[model samples]
Target: MIPVKISEEAIKEVRNIMENKNIPDGYGLRVGVRGGGGCSAAGMNYILGFDKPKNTDKTFEVDGIPVYIDKGHVMYVIGMEVRFHNGNDAKGFVFVNPEIEKELN
Candidate 1:
């Protein structure tokens, strides 16, 4: 099973994007880690985008949305929750990972 989860709000937003953003057919949500330490509270940054799977990827479905995660990145990203935040100040998907926090502690 995928060790991560996507919030209802995030899933809704993804659906909205899929309909209005014209994401290419066969593309799926890609979740992985970025190497830049400064980009997130955790040393590794989070990656979320739409792309096709490659040989090195592990694929799954979350709420009917296809998801792809590079096999190498799975360890660093486990137990994460993907959420959408919309407020007066900002709006976008926000990643919350207690697993990383436990490690950092």
Candidate 2:
């Protein structure tokens, strides 16, 4: 199973983007953490992009989408869920971590 789970809505949008953007073969979605992430209260911010798997990466095929996670970032995003929001306030994928939500409470 993937360390991070993606919601169904996010999956559909990602597939559309991959087709429209013409993402190259052998390249897949990369999920990772960026330090001091803005728009989030978590210790690290999550990032999504298309990239070729690196030697240090672990790959997962989720619903026909290839996902890559660098080893060092695995722990940070474990159990996290990625959702797509297309409301008036936001129009993007939002990362939600249950652990972080608990801490915030």
Candidate 3:
């Protein structure tokens, strides 16, 4: 089973961007954690970008969209859903991770 779920809208948007940008094959959307170092304790955050899977990356396909996630970040991203928001407050991809939300609450 796929580790994460990607919304159809999000997939469409990503595909459109990929076509417009002329991104080549072998490149996929990468979902990984960043920012755990430095003096300030801001904590880890998610990042999304077009990149090639690294040796330690785990790949998943959602609606034909290739997604690469670092092996170490699999736990944090598991069961998460990526959705596209066009609402007034936000107009981009949003990650819905129940586990993290519960922890934050």
Q: Which candidate tops lDDT?
A: 2
Q: Which candidate leads in TM-score?
A: 2
**Higher lDDT: candidate 1 or 2?**
2
Ranking 1 against 3 by lDDT, winner: 1
In model 2, where is the ten-residue run with the lowest total lDDT? 36-45
lDDT score of model 1? 0.88
Off by over 4 Å in 2: 37-41, 99-105
Instruction: Give the worst 10-residue stretch by lDDT in candidate 3.
Output: 37-46
lDDT of 2 by residue, 5-81 (tens): 89999999999999999899888899999887555436587899999999999999989999999998888789999
The CA lDDT at 50 in model 2 is 91
Give every collision pair in model 1. Answer: none
TM-score of 2: 0.86
List runs of model 1 lying over 4 Å from the truth.
Answer: 36-41, 99-105
For the record, the alpha-carbon RMSD of candidate 1 to the native fold, in angstroms, is 3.8
List model 3 lDDT by residue over 36-94, tens digit each.
76543246677888998799998888767788998978876678888888898879998
lDDT of 1 by residue, 61-105 (tens): 988899999998888778889999999999999888766668899
Angstrom error at residue 23, model 3: 1.7
Candidate lDDT (C-alpha), each? 0.88, 0.89, 0.82
